[model samples]
Target: MSDFVTPVLLMQTLAAVREAGRIITEAWEKPRSIKYKGPIDLVTETDVAVETFLGKRLREILPEANVLGEEGSPAARPEGTTWIIDPVDGTTNFAHSIPQCGISLALWRNDTVEMGIVYLPAEDELFHAVRGEGAFLNGKEISVTDESDVEHALVATGFPYSIREDIDIVMQNLRAVLMTTQGVRRFGSAATDLAYTACGRFDAYYEIRLKPWDLAAGWLLVEEAGGKVTLYDGVTPFDFGKGILASNGKVHKAVAALITDTDD
Candidate 1:
């Protein structure tokens, strides 16, 4: 892909995402009114409001780009250049007044993610990266760790919402990692976990059955930060709603081997 994206466009897109953060922050100040989209799945008014705000502002920034968001706007898979977004990545955490959730946005040019921005409103943290241009946190550059040993590396992971169907695989992988790594953490937000991995805060992150919006932006961040992201098998390209394995490249192969099921 050519370096067609302009600085003005990135500036405008960041402004829109920050606006979404502002909306989320405003909603956080009030008593949360939570609604259930499934038995354990959640959707909050803040999610809808932020998505709506983002949709409007982003379209203004790129009129030619289509929008695909988690909150039900433009439900179909995007065609051509599009924007993939998750208004609130950790609805359950936010509902409990936990501050681990954030907004995720990425620019998709056909199959490749061209730009990504993940904003945590609670902490005022903004992570963004453009294709081929390295990753950044609040304008400062960032990179993944060089740690090569899984025994000393800190790892992060998440459970699929349909735990009943995937619990066996989840626990098996968790057990393997917990047995070998420095420790493991489940922070409830895939975006944040991936972003943290990009900045060397976490050496790696893995999860299954995640939607595109969950990791779209963060995936770009990790790759641009000198890390690698792939499917669990370690060779396939990770896609929407699939299992993902990301690491600092040093421990990737070793970690993938540990997590993979030989029977499967």
Candidate 2:
């Protein structure tokens, strides 16, 4: 693994994600052709269009790197250098005319994330992190909050699509956090929530049932910003199957304890 990522490659990936965000935002502004993958899971024409655009762009720049996107790619584990993307992070919000969505992109080399970018087109905020390098937001260095007390921290979280089918588990977890934290928010986009946490806008975040495309980029960003990311049991947050618990290092243990207590 190389110790440095060229600014050119980073810029290229950022541009691609930005371009994809623009395409999704444009489609979002107008009426969209929507489809259902399941009862609550949604897919929009823009989702496919953006993924195609991103896959093609990334391939042009890093042809050897495998691409895994939310709308495309096989179920194979990413090998060598792989780019995992979520063209539109909040498809549910996009379909409903809410502007709280963005694009997420991450490059993994040898099973570890080398770089990641999250772009919020509506806000024009770009969050990025390169391995061994610090995290940034709009070219300015950013860091996690110093808040250590879980009771004083503002936390964010999300419910999985299985909430309807597993309502009891979801509600119990939600209630646990709500009663413990100073504040709680559910933004429908795990990428954005994690990005926000990295920049100190949120002190911590946790959720169950997320995909690689959902947390790949944001995980690197949070860690680079001096935050902690792991499962509710305090394990590394690399599993695509289980959910995650992330905080600014200070409150991680407290948050993990709360989550596990809720489970118990």
Candidate 3:
């Protein structure tokens, strides 16, 4: 564990996140004031409100750590301790009164994640992990699936917001994965996908063109749960740029081969 992470700090962080979760739940009950960032991309007032609250509270909790949120934040930050947050990971689902959305928060420093928490307030499921420790949902420990066969694995994925230009590639990879895996699911939330993978709910999860806030926390959760995370090539490290594929380690290479068509 990093010198920055302590039991008290972790508890403080979780309390702040749970408070943020209350904000999401409150906003979710009423109609959302939605705005489109792009043709299909969404940003709700709830998203902004939660991010704002998190920014304020987290700053108070860790005075040294800067906040990098999905909303109103720089695309990247310099080397330092930072809080990477997705106020609402599944805004579309939340807008539709679905229960799959959640708040994703991670303590990131010097290219490593010290801790991560993905809390679905609507469903009341909170998944968290600390480096060198293990993953947990609510309070129970969690781990990735042990399945090693691609044909029997249940996979999860999401398309990029810029899907219009990458439809060909998205569909191509989707088709290959669908044929290879026993089943495929798109929950419309990258954070949820990774959290589910960490808890063994999904054997693997992959996507392209994701921001740091979306993958930062879940990245550590997957690894802590004894899984593997990488780009489509299966060897390259993910710098929060694109092509993220996370699996149970047992079936990582096989799924990567399917997505990249390297098996052919």
Candidate 4:
């Protein structure tokens, strides 16, 4: 892909994402009326408000681009360029008063992600990456760690909402990795976990049954940061429905080996 992301466009997009995060943060600090979308799934007023705000701003800035958001998207996936958005990535955590949620946005040209932005309002951290350009966290260039030994690496992971029924498979994979890694953490936010991995805060990250909005932006950030991300089988992991595995390129192969089960 050509360098379609000019510096001005990048700055504008980052500003929009930051503003969206601020909206979420404001609602988070106040009393939020929450409801259930599914058995354990949730939907908050903040999520809808943030998504609406982002969709409007993005359309005004890039009218030619389509939008695919977690809260609401077009009936059919549009052709050419599209924006994937997750207004609040860690809704469960946010509902529980945990400050681990954030907003994730990605621009997809054809089938490839051209740019990504993830903003954490609570921490005032902004992570962004453009195709072929390096990743950054709050204006500082960032890269994955060079730690090659799995036993010496800190790992991060998340459980699928289907954990109620597929607990065995998820636990089995978790157990396998926990035994080999130096430490494991479940922060309940896939975007944040992947962003952290790209910045060397976490050596690796993995998760199952995530949507495109959950991984699209963060995936590009990790790859641009000199890291590697793929499916459990070591293939390119672009399908939003399947799952994802990401690492600092050092323990990627080792981690992939332990979670290669295909049977659901």
Query: What TM-score does candidate 4 get on C-alpha atoms?
Result: 0.95
Report the C-alpha displacement of residue 152, candidate 4, in angstroms: 0.9
lDDT of each residue in 1-264, candidate 4, tens digit only: 337888888888998998888887787768878998778888899989989999999998789998998889753333478888999999998887788789999998967889999898888899999999899999999999999999998999998777798788788889999999998999999999999999999999988888888888999999999999888876666465666889998898888877744343
* Model 4 / residue 28 / CA error / Å: 2.3
> What's the residue-level lDDT of 63 in candidate 4?
91
**Model 4 regions more than 4 Å off:** 74-79, 261-264
Clashing pairs in 4: none
lDDT per residue as tens, model 1, 87-134: 999989888777889999999995899999999989999999999999
Once fitted onto the true fold, the runs of candidate 1 whose alpha carbons sit more than 4 angstroms away are: 74-76, 261-263
| lDDT accuracy of residue 233 in candidate 1 | 73
| Per-residue accuracy of model 3 over 1-264 as CA lDDT, tens digit each | 557689999899899999999998887778889999889989999999999999999989898888899997865742588999899998899999889898999998877889999999998999999998888999899999999889999999998898988888889999999988999999999999999999999999999888888888899999999999988888787666668999999999999888852222
Give the lDDT of residue 231 in candidate 3: 85
* The 10-residue segment with the lowest total lDDT in model 1: 255-264
- Taking every candidate in turn, the Cα RMSD to the unseen true structure, in Å, is 1.6, 1.9, 2.0, 1.6
lDDT by candidate, in order shown: 0.89, 0.85, 0.89, 0.87
Question: Distance from true position, residue 104, model 1, in Å?
Answer: 0.1
Residue 208, model 3, lDDT: 87
